[model samples]
Target chain A: MIHFDQVSKRYQSGHEALRNVSFRLAAGEMAFLTGHSGAGKTTLLRLVALVERASRGQVLIGGQNLNRLAHRKIPYFRRNIGLVFQDHRLLPERTVFDNVALPLVIAGARHQEIARRVRAALDKVGLLGKERLHPLTLSGGEQQRVGIARAVVNKPPILLADEPTGNLDPELSREIMGLFGSFSNFGVTVLIATHDIELIQRMNTRTLVLSKGCLVDD
Target chain B: MRAKATTPHFERGPRFQLRAWLLRHLQTLFSALGELTRSPLGTAMTAGVIGIALALPAGLYVFLDNVQAVGQNWDGKVEISLFLKDQIDDEAASRFALSLHKRSELRHVQLITRAEALEEYRQLSGFAEALNAFEQENPLPALVLVEPTLRYAQPEAIKGLVAELGRLPAVELAQFDLEWLQRLHAIIHTLKRGVVVLAALLALGVLLIVGNTIRLGIENRRAEIEIIQLVGATDAFIRRPFLYTGFCFGLLGALMAWLLVEGGLWLVRGPLAELASLYQANFLLASLGLRASLVLCLMGALLGLAGSWLAVRRHLRGIEVG
Candidate 1:
């Protein structure tokens, strides 16, 4: 579960990225956030992931206020959430399986468990056969799929995607959305931030729209 | 029920967690080694610099040790001459010399009767034939040549021993080559201090070299580090591989330095022995003792670890999730 109770964020350069944004998504609920290029969609997701702290108010996940989390606990707290980026952010030096296994490795998983979980996550992303291949050798869509596999590999309760399909074709984007839908059905609280209105309509799920630095519609 | 049971979050037994922790450390350590292998030339260059830095001080120290050994050898030969009292006869002087040999401090005592003293003086002095003018009176007094044991031959110890011998009733006066011994001890002391100072400076150099290399390593892996941190890896977890990298660098550098020093000693051993033989002295080049070599290696590794720790602690703080 994720909640933003009147949260706001401002950069060091006096740029207001978010202003009094408020929203909540219950456990197992899937939603989309739509906004223009500089409308703070990324900033809002960053707050949920605790990658950026709110300048004001609280951002809570599963009832734990992230603002109160100590710096030392930040990494461990991140174990409970998953994030996927538009550029895939997969390590090109490692194999697809290793990229997915990063989270489990960070969690200190046993070798057998890491292998099993990585294979299972790769299967979920329809990348089970490409586990041994390098990310650079894979197509952009496959690379993005590997990133998704990695995000969910730790079995995080919540998953956040930031323009995950930005570089993909329409077909690939739909497929990636379908993968997110499947994850939502499996009880993961999925939230995707993208301004692709047509894709959001095709998603046909609950959508929140942002304008400038405020949540205009939800 | 099946989904809950099959979730990746299986029950973590205490033993299982312990094993995971061990596995993680080993993996990181080995991965650091693998990373070195990935860029062999770079690693070698960094380690080579550390090796040269380490070897310089170590070589100088070994040289100083050998020089000190030579000084000690020369010190052992220093003689304290006890000119017997005029009333003392050759028999009395011989008795005193024999008694002096019984003391633990004196290694050797040679009694030179008044006749032998005159003969030795005649053999050395250019006015040898003129030395016999005292044949009737034999003005050269009966003498005892004293050689102290190696330990007592040191400048401070020899001073006390000479003073004690000088106070003997049968002895007229004790004469020791004090000025030369004093100067040798002073030079040895200065050389020892110089070795220590040089070692410390070179150690600091090693630290700087290791730190700069580790900084470069961190910079190269900056992207990966950010990603790892974002994916829930703790600072310590992120630092483990780098620490191991530093450790490996230090260990390798120390090994290189050790080899360099030993090889240098080996190459110079024959020539040094030959020079000693030219002086009719049995001297050999002193390689570092086993303990000293081990300490040097350990020091190298520790410096490497310290340098990397400094580099990582400073730079990791500069990196934030935002």
Candidate 2:
């Protein structure tokens, strides 16, 4: 569903963050993006998310070239793509239900549908009872689960996770990865960027590795 | 299958209605409002600052308005006084008054004969016995009290007419009681300019107050905003809550200022009424009227909105989501 054709990104400080990186993920595919610290993994995902424009190459999502899309239209494009961070990124002041329902809210879903979908998403992540609780009240693993629930709540076709398990212990990381794997089985395209080699081996997913601002392996 | 059927129907309805877009984003707006309400003390403090800043100029404005209303009543009392030569008799003064009555500039003219003037002066001065002791004659001149037409009541026009009357053979001197009016007009004009400058300076103060508040709010929410952006939230979406916070502060401030000004007016109303009674006048201190109040509210809102917009536009650009 996403294609990066030799995409390159450069900062104004003369640092080339991504140099001629190219990759493609088929529809409903699950993949892991492995890279060390200061690697171009985040930049690659950001390009697909259309947060940063490729300096000299095309980044395509769902057959639309993101580099050519108008800035005002970016939000509309983002409505179909879900992003999760290592920190979970749930609004600290809001309840789990509200955070999970945010994307649907942004998409202008009906209130009843939002309630229903948020409940179902929370249920799927084993957070059904914590709907009204704030993120700070939840454990790190539970918070990440809430993040995952939020990411998939809008039923976005593509889900991107950057270091979703970085802050978790081995057991919690396994649980989060299993949750992602379950989402893939539901036909949601999943791409996770992580540095955990052991976890990557256990997941048995397609792996793309990057080093020093360049994609070294796929 | 039921879920699929419901989904398409739900999806179709939103596609046709533009209001759905706003309704869909209501959560974001409500979330923003919730954040503002979360810290009631901080919110109240910021709003109080805005209110004080706005009330200073608004109170001065009301004062200027009251002054103008009182001044308007006295504008009609302006008139010119013609003093005839000491040798000029009552008959000549009466003829001169009659001549002046024919002029378009003269609204009404009354001839005060020298003997009648001396008799009135004796009555007013409590000098009846002293005047009788003088024996020969009172040296007071025959006077003409001339009320000018409203159109010719202005200082320049009255001055021109007075100069013309001064040149008349029977006239010794001509004076208009416009000196006080002229002084009042000059003072009001200067006060208006001063109020404008003061309002401008106070407006800047309000901007800075609101700007600083928003800046602090942004700093507090910096991490959350970075995370929001990382999760594909646009700058507009991230900035929405702060803008709403600023607007709320401004709106609350306006309400407080309105109360402050009204309270001040109420406190002084009784004394002002007594002062008016002393002058034997029915003067009412004017309050901030509907239009002025509306303007004040709108100004407060704009100040808040503009201040937040500036703060967000400047600061948000520097934040990069990792």
Instruction: Estimate every model's Cα lDDT from 0 to 1.
Output: 0.87, 0.82
Candidate 1 residue-wise lDDT, B1-322, digit = tens:
0112122353388888787778878888899899999899988888888888899888988887888787777665888999899998877777888889889998889898988888877866667778657657787889888899889887789899999999989999999988875687788789888878988898888878888888888898888888888888889998888889998899889988999999999999999889877766888777899998999889999999998998889888888765
- CAPRI rating of model 1: acceptable
Measured against the true two-chain complex, the DockQ scores of the candidates, in the order shown, are 0.42, 0.28
Query: Lowest summed lDDT over 10 consecutive residues: which window, candidate 2 chain A?
Result: A102-111
**Candidate 1 colliding pairs:** none
Best by DockQ: 1
Query: Could you tell me how far off, in angstroms, the CA of residue B216 lies in candidate 1 after the best superposition?
Result: 1.3
Report the C-alpha lDDT of model 2 over B143-167, residue by residue, as the tens digit. 9988889888876887888899899
Model 1, position B261: C-alpha lDDT score: 94
lDDT of 1 at A173: 94
Docking quality of model 2: it rates as: acceptable
How do all models score by TM-score?
0.87, 0.83
